[model samples]
Target: MAPHERACFYVQAQAPQEKLAFYFAVQSGGNFDIDYEVTNPAGGVVLDGQKERQGDFVFAARSAGEHAFCFSNTMSSFAEKMLDFDVTAEHETQADHPSRQNPLPNAAKQREQAAQSLSTIDEMASRIATGLTNFHRSLRHYHTRLHRNMDTVRSTESRVFWFAVMEVAFITGVVGAQIMAIQTLFNTSGKARV
Candidate 1:
């Protein structure tokens, strides 16, 4: 691809340590995997993974190029399945790019600074989305485990409640029997004295 063709105006200065990532879709006509290998123009491997399941094939691009990205789905073990994928080049400007490099309408030299500002906001939104996804996954895993143990706890509570009920009944019975015996003794003594 040309310089500007594949090179989307990315927030490089702000996120210096962050790499450019693209989500790819993989589909197989047979029981195989579209295992992918992403390499730079220099043949250096940037990423290598198999899209075994239906999920984001996330990767990072260091520099611009028709970066030799490849995928394979030819396993001999499983029945031929189907796969579909899309390469969504992310980490670049989604809403901000024009104003940073080129000027928008009405402005000649100073491209409306909206591009950079909007890109910053875009970066924030992206981070928030990622964070929320992670939090949600963690919450799901935690809830699953919590509920798994909760059944045992519920059964334990039932046993404890039943034990408490039996103890209460026993105590009440003993107290009533003692009261009846004391009344009988008083009546018998009074009658004998009469």
Candidate 2:
């Protein structure tokens, strides 16, 4: 992004009352700070921050439509920003659990209870899977950053080492040239005019 430029994105929620979560960070840029805001479909600002490096927010969607998320570099005079962000929407299911059964026969009640138990187990497993996915993503992101940093450090070290070697060689050459010139002058002066 350029100075005073704005970058915006929109995410659409299919249903009302859906859970929308946003996480973002200024990973690298001229400055690690940016201005950001998230607005609902009604154009009302739901979340905002100024000069912030990172943010995490979870809010319920009031309506089914597009939500706008924006980042601005207006605060920076000539600095661009690199941002990493994620927006996740989870829709709550309206399925009725079998446990909410009315009065029934013994066998019927037992079957209903078993179905409810299975539903509960399935929900738990789904949650665990989602958690694991997020964890793995975070780990991969951090690992990439670590490797990039190490590469930069290694490249800088190599450049510095080569620069020092070149400097020493140049200095030695200059000293040798000066010594030779001095010796030549002395020998010429010591010889008698012939």
Candidate 3:
């Protein structure tokens, strides 16, 4: 984004009290920081910050509607910013317990409990898998940036070294020429006096 500009992206939450999770970062920017704000559909601020490089947040939805996540590069006058973000909405997925005329048998209750436990475990596993994938992706991006920076450093070093070598060679040639000129002048003067 250009300097002093703000961009907003929104995700809709259909059900009230759903979970909203966001991961945001200024992947490349003037100073690796930018202004950000998260607002609910009613224009209530959920989160706000300035000069932040990254943030991971989870907020419970109070109202069901579009939630806006905004990023601003307003502090910088001449620099552009690049942002990366992911927003996820998780709704209640578990079924409510059914009303029954009689108490469930012990075995059935145990089986139901087991199923719930398994569901919870599955949800946790899925979250873990997603986290790991995002982590690896971030790692790869950093690795590529590191390699590019190293290449730039190497190029600069090589240029500086060659420039220094050329400067020394030029100075040596000039000094030699001066010495030769002085010797020739002295010889001519001595011969003329003789």
Among these predicted structures, which one has the highest lDDT? 2
lDDT of 1: 0.53
Candidate 3 regions exceeding 4 Å error are 96-194
How would you encode candidate 1's per-residue C-alpha lDDT over 18-107 as one tens digit per residue?
344444432323322345666665678766776343334345555555555554444434444433333434444444355566564577
Model 1 Cα RMSD, Å? Answer: 16.9
Please give each candidate's TM-score. Answer: 0.33, 0.65, 0.61
After aligning candidate 1 to the native by TM-score, how far in Å is the CA of 33 from where it should be?
A: 4.0
Regions of model 1 farther than 4 Å from truth: 1-20, 24-32, 54-59, 77-79, 91-194
TM-score of 3: 0.61
lDDT, candidate 3, 85-189, per-residue tens: 788898766654342224467667766776678778778988998899679667756754665466567778999999999999999999999999989877786
Order by TM-score, highest first: 2, 3, 1
| Total clashes in model 3, counting residue pairs 3 or more apart in sequence or in different chains | 0
Q: How far is candidate 3 from the true structure (C-alpha RMSD, Å)?
A: 5.4
Better of 1 and 2 by TM-score: 2
Give the alpha carbon lDDT tens digit for every residue of 1-194 in model 2. 78999989999989999999887777666547889999999999989999987777789999999999999999899777777788888777756655555636767868777877878898898999889968966875685466546656777899999999999999999999999998877788435624
Report clashes for each candidate as comma-separated counts: 13, 0, 0
Model 2 bad stretches (over 4 Å): 2-4, 14-17, 31-33, 50-52, 62-64, 75-82, 97-106, 140-144, 147-194
Best by TM-score: 2
